[model samples]
Structures are given as C-alpha cells and as structure tokens.
Target: MSEQSVTFRYRMSDRDVFYGGGVVNGARSITLANEAANRLMAKVFQNTGHCIEVRKVRLYEPCFAGDYMEFMARVRKMEGNRAVLEVRSFKIIEVPENPPYPSSIDVLPEPLLSTVVQFVYETY
Candidate 1:
C-alpha cells in the first residue's frame, strides 16, 4: 500500500485558536502536516516488516489563525532505510463570518511552511 500522494482535510476549532491563553494549541496546520506524513508512512509500510519514524520535522510556512487547513504529502525518494517526503499545507479562509461586523476578512493566518523532512525506517 504505497502512496505517492496523501491529503488530509480538517477544520479549526475554538481549542485550535490561541488567544493569549494556555490551550496547548489543538489541531493546527503544522500538526495536520505531521499527521499527514505519518499517515502516508503508515500506508506505505502497511503490513510490511519496515517501520518508519520521523527523523526530523520543520515548518516552512506558518499556519494562519482561524482557517481550515489541508496538508498534502508526496513521497519524493526512497532508499534502503531512508525516505524523503515533501509536504505542503494550505489554509482556506473563504468561510463566511459572523454577522453585524465589518467587510469580509481573511482570518486565515500565514501558513506555517516547512521544508522536506527525511524519515528513517528500520527493518528486521
């Protein structure tokens, strides 16, 4: 079950919003990206003796606040026990806002971009 591309879509909740409070930052764009990669790796190694672990993770873009985020993962290259994955997260800010206010606003915060992360797998 090798996947060249994987996409995960999720919405933002109040918990996901940070308003100068301690909420541990629920599900955000970065989290979604990591989860997408993990899910992709899980699919790639499904039922196989090989298991993958994220060696490094970085954000190339900053996830905006109050926006729906989508993470896309693509398998770039694969070696014996190492694989390179490219992931990009996009935030959609076209959702309608509450009434009795100003004009349409782009609540979507700047996406937390990330570079390609290399993952290593161990097989026995």
Candidate 2:
C-alpha cells in the first residue's frame, strides 16, 4: 500500500453537457476517475499502468455544466503487479440559480460527493 494520491480539478463546460438541463453524463465521472488513477499509479509505481477492471462504481449525485469538480485517486493496496486505486469525485463549486451576474458562482461549504469508483490496474 502506498500513501500516494493525486487530485484533478475541472470545470464543466457546455461541451460537457450530455443531456437536457445541462446534466453531464455519468460516464464522465468514470473517465475522470481513470485519469486520476493513471496519474496516481505512475507516481506510486514509477511506471504506467493499464486499468484492468472497474471493481465498483457509484454515482451519488448529478453533475451539470458550470459545476466545478474535484477528482482524487489514491493507491489502496497492491499485490504483485496488480494495484487497486480508490477514486472519488466531488462538486466544490456550482453556478447560482437566477444569477444576477453571468459569472455568479457559489462555493459549497462542504463538498458534495458525486461519485466513487474502485479500479484495478496492472502495472508495467
């Protein structure tokens, strides 16, 4: 097990909206999680790793365009050449409703957990 971790922050744009109401697709979280895992695995193993399986995934909240998200990944355990990574996604900021200004945004006092995923990877 390694205590190493990585964080990726992104702001959803109109391009990220997948459906009506600016709702982003749930699959986007998976993609972000994999990215976080890739970065973290490289730091932990000193080599690239390929995701072999997504052991578990849960989407707890909806993400919308204009949402600022944070993705984090940590090395949980390792066996031989296989490593397990835990990834979490959070919504840290959101666009305000009926904003008086175009750039109006609200930062959540407590980050909202949007997704959680467990990924298994094979290190080179």
The clash numbers for all candidates, in the given order, read 16, 0
The numbered model that scores best in lDDT is 2
Model 1 segments more than 4 A misplaced = 1-3, 19-27, 47-65, 94-124
| lDDT (Cα, tens digit) per residue for candidate 2, span 1-124 | 5778999899988998899998999998889888899889888888767889889999998999999999999988997889989999999999987888999999999999999999999998
Candidate 2 — what's its lDDT?
0.92
lDDT, candidate 2, at 110:
99
Cα lDDT tens digits for candidate 1, 1-124 = 2357788766665566664532225335546666676777666755223336666555554333445667787776776666566567666552444635543446445544333454454533
* Model 1 score (lDDT): 0.56
Q: What is the lDDT of residue 4 in candidate 2?
A: 82
